[model samples]
Target: MSRRVLIKTLPLHTNYGGIVQAYALQRAIRDLGHRAVVDTGDPISLRRRVLHRAWAVRRAVRMLLPARVDWDWRASREVLAPQQSFVRRHLSRASAVERADTRRGRARLARRFDTFVVGSDQVWRAAYAEIPEQFLEVIEEFHGPRPRRVSYAASFGRDDIDEYSEAERARATELIRRFDAVSVREESGIGICADAFGVHAERHLDPTMLLTPGHYRGLVARARTDPTPAAGRTLVYRLDATDDMLRAERAIAERVGAPAMELLPTASPGSYGEYAADRARFDRPSVERWLASIASADFVVTDSYHGCVFSILFNRPFVVHANARRGAARFDSLLGVFGLEHHRAGASADGIDDRVFTPDWSHVNRVLEAERARATAYLVENL
Candidate 1:
């Protein structure tokens, strides 16, 4: 019997890692003979919301920019205000509406399935949340008593329970205990949940790593582009901004005599077209094209989680930059799983002198196969 599975998360909205992981998981779930759909836990159409958000972001950025051209109080305050109580509350309410919208959206998507798999990103981040009650209520309504509640690759990221007050920790623990099966995307997360939430959960790889590069080779092949290797320079790049990390990438490229290519964010005509702009970079006679372009890259330097995950999958040497963002500490734990601690990036590129490439695909592949089997079984048995 085909299982109806509703997968939930705050869709990548703009991040490449988020999109790839969500799509990979959706594909993997579908391969299990189940119907799986990604619901960003919000009903708001991101495409429609982009213009308003872009304008808001522009306003915030402009207000925050210093008059003297320095990153001073006025500029910092504008950027910092979003973290204030009033702004947080307003954002939370906006999110609640979005979640309610997601619930309404799910009603149409939920009709075809039986199980709901929730996760693969920082869906529990407080900044992105309205209220716990509002969040939990939506979860229960759609994935209530009947369908098995499986947290495929959920993460709390850097927000440790210990950091919260005793009451908040207890409350979170109670909420976490409700899940039927919980799996985190990093080993450190397992410890966090076990010690903090008082629940033992398995740690799994990002969905992108679950399938081999060959599985996605066809997609890359279709988007093949003329090789753009810079004589001796290799491609060094990142998703978001990181001066030190980008510097490190340049250092590596120079040391190896390779030019670096950085992939930047592209505007989506619609949410579904997030990868549409990138489509040109990977086009081929028969392949999806974008995949091919990424595969052809000599090396990758990125701070994005999905970047590291895909780099490993494609056998590309790369560096993973740590995010200084408040809730993104999970990167450390994720890299630890692959024994790639050396690849971690911080504020300064201090230690890594001239190491060119270090990746253990053999061990990574074995672990991936084992976890994929377990994840696949969990879906099949529950469905």
Candidate 2:
């Protein structure tokens, strides 16, 4: 039987992983014969919107000024605009619910769906945990016939559970207990949920892994093909680009005898060195463009989790740098899944092998198939 399923996750345009994972999960649900929709709930306050407008105005002024602006403001706008437009045009299918921050808003919205999913990202983290709608706090507190509340691959963003205050921990415990079924993205998250909520949560693959590489190929095929795609080049997709990281990327590129190219974030707020500035830069890459870049790369160096994910999917040789600020648990869990823990790059770029190392795809695919089956089973049974 088909049911109306509503998924609540981070904002669609926040980053590539968030957007792709949201689309992947919704697609997976639809593949299972249910009508799925991503609920881009209205949670931003009016004050924040005003501040955003003010920032945009300031940026526009800076772009028009005589002083040479290092930032590729026009490129960033061009890249990001199409991405948002893609989501609005191709990804989202349901009319979004307005006023989701209040009880009245959630109550009104709940009546429209038979089930609610909170997942495929850091929805369980402290930052979004308090949001009644995102964490299913509203569904847990619903007075009328409550919709089926399930969490799929939800990450706490860290291994430690002590980050929450005593009251907040209590509330989280209460809310999580009300979930019909809870699945976490990382293995560590299972323990955190168990320790904090005294509830056992299953470990599931990230939504990106839920789909096969062939499914992603379709998206890449649709992307506007690059007229002059780079060959035998190292594609560096770093979320936290430090001076040392940039140096390491250059060294690797030199060792491999390939040019170094970077996929610039839509809103990276840092200065690049002369070496980095000299290399090619892809600013504000759309999801399709991002996928195509990774698919065509000879090798990849990245600190982003999804970066690691697509590299694996494409069966590309890649190195994952430790992103301490974003927490290492995500990488640890994912790398451990594919038995690629040795792929983690050290602090220094030296001793990093120059040649592309082939992964054991037969084994990797087996593991992926098993995890995919388990995750899909959970969703099928729950929803």
Candidate 3:
């Protein structure tokens, strides 16, 4: 039986983590022979970061160059809309569908989608100071109770729901009640929903776990078809990653006696051409090639949860650098989930340690599969 499904998430169409989550869910829905349409609430909104015209010009220039090219057009517009009317107008003009989400427009929009899956990122944070009530208001108007509401891999920090303010707790309770089922990404989230919202949300794995490393191997193979780092070593880093982390990666590569290369998730074709121009010890590969390189590397050093998850999945020894900017506490919460304390700290030049590299994935896999099955069952029944 085929049915239409709508997915609402945070930071969609940008970042490997967000893309992988959205892609995996949509893929799962499609595998079940359903029509899944994923549309996220704007990351930038009237209550969020305000974007300015000057910033827009600077951003437009930045997008044209290889440096500071990690901008996600969607995320940028969402985070900066309140501050920059020019950017809001700019992206709004470019996007025909999302721009019409006015109070008068929402009623008609609600009639279109059969079910809405709201989750897979830091959207729960909206209950905090950063977001406005309108965000939930719009979603509630579009996806009311009994319309097959489900939350896939949502998360809250280690602190209990009592940690939230009265307004936030009230909002959370109401939203959680409206959902048919809510599945969280970490054990902490279960406590949060139960204690704070008075709703029962089961603990589940991040959607990235739904697919095995073997499933991602095709992109890896494609990435390695012609690669200089294929025979040596490589390090993939996200934009927010620090210089110290890169140094640790290089030191590990050097200790292993292999040349090292850097990997970027998003870059222009011409940037790849520039990287190709450099015949030095370091070489850049396509994103697929980068993932392949990590799979085939002497060691992997990253600040990404997916990177850490996949490293363990592939049985590769890795170092997960704490992301200080985003808050290492969240990383700590996730690391605790897999019992991977050794690989969960700040970066160091330490050579690959077998103990840290080796985790009992056999046990982890069983837990992960059960969560995936639960999530799948929710989607299947809702449809």
Candidate 4:
């Protein structure tokens, strides 16, 4: 009953949603009385790898200079320090030996973890993949005496496979079939799995939805200086804030009679010199602080998948700006989960739709309670 579990997900870093979702799944597994550790230190993109190496050399020379120059490496270390610290504090991580990418490495991995889970994010999207095999390497690379493989709420980012080539689709089908269980985060994903892989996949909640809002509030309370319980404030969280989105946020704030706070990406790149040294491109809120902003908000308007997730978890009345580029199908699937798809709409100038702010909390909670039970049952049966 007490099996060791290894969680395979998008590399934990600045992406708040990615980090929180990974945290949620691992936490969920451990709460079930199983040992779970998330695998970290994943390979970076080729461009980033090259940039990091260049920065390392520059940093070495700058350290010896009369006037020290702040490079990306040092600044990045500062920005990600809190996030790294959070992972260490809140989650168990695989040691380097257990995370090795070699045959011997996987052997060590197989010996430690009885089951491997790839999930709770866009793990199957090739464009989003850092490692060559993407998240599929858990099964594709480990050849001998493989661990039980499961995909919990794994997403291809979109229902359409326009970005996935014919070859990638073929390989994905092969790797997908190897999983003992498969659950997708979107209803549209269920059909994609059936049609593409010829395997039945269940639609499940995003891992963050598995936990209660109180659990997240507890995290917010841990922050030393992070503000929490923001009363009478409308939170604007957008991946790409267009003019329309901004106007919508302003209108929503005006209508609600609450001040608006824009929560932009703290991890935006391009910081150098004294200005970069003195200030980050944006204030890098600790992981808990980021959650606190959402947890405490009176209302939220976001284009992010995870933004929508937290709003629902906190039972905040909110509308999503359909981010079709990142994956609008996910929004469709997520809102459809609570039968609240009308909650997503374009933020046009004429007016922000009335449905954006009026939500039936009682009905949403009823659906969430039932869905959480179904999702937990799937996890219990699998891990």
lDDT of 1 by residue, 1-383 (tens): 77767776664433445656767787787777766666664545667667668988887787555454443334334322322322222111123224344655445334444665667776655555432431243444565334466777776666464445565556667767876778777666787877776778887777777666887775444435343332233544455565666677777676555677645422212321222334444221222233444566776766666666666677677666766463456777766666666776555545663442756768867766777787777656655
Task: Score candidate 2 by lDDT.
Answer: 0.77
Tens-digit lDDT track for model 3 on 135-220? 24455644333345677777553344444667766766787787787877767777777876788887666776677677667645
Clash count for candidate 4 is 0
Q: How does each model score on TM-score?
A: 0.69, 0.84, 0.70, 0.88
The parts of candidate 3 lying over 4 Å away from their true place are: 41-104, 127-136, 142-146, 157-169, 219-231, 234-247, 265-287, 327-330, 347-354, 358-371
| Model 1 vs. true fold: TM | 0.69
lDDT of each: 0.58, 0.77, 0.58, 0.78
> Of models 1 and 3, which has the larger TM-score?
3
Clashes of each: 35, 0, 10, 0
lDDT score for residue 123 of model 3: 55
Residue 258 accuracy (lDDT) in model 1: 64
Question: What is residue 128's positional error in candidate 1, in angstroms?
Answer: 3.2
lDDT of 1 at 347: 57
RMSD of each: 10.1, 4.8, 7.6, 3.6
> Of the pair 2 and 3, which is ahead by TM-score?
2
lDDT of 2 by residue, 128-192 (tens): 44544455665554467788888999988788765677877777778878889999999999899
> Which tens-of-lDDT digit does each residue in 91-127 have in candidate 4?
8876433245566665676777788888878887777
Off by over 4 Å in 4: 41-68, 95-100, 130-132, 138-144, 225-229, 265-281, 349-351
Worst 10 residues of 2 by lDDT: 271-280
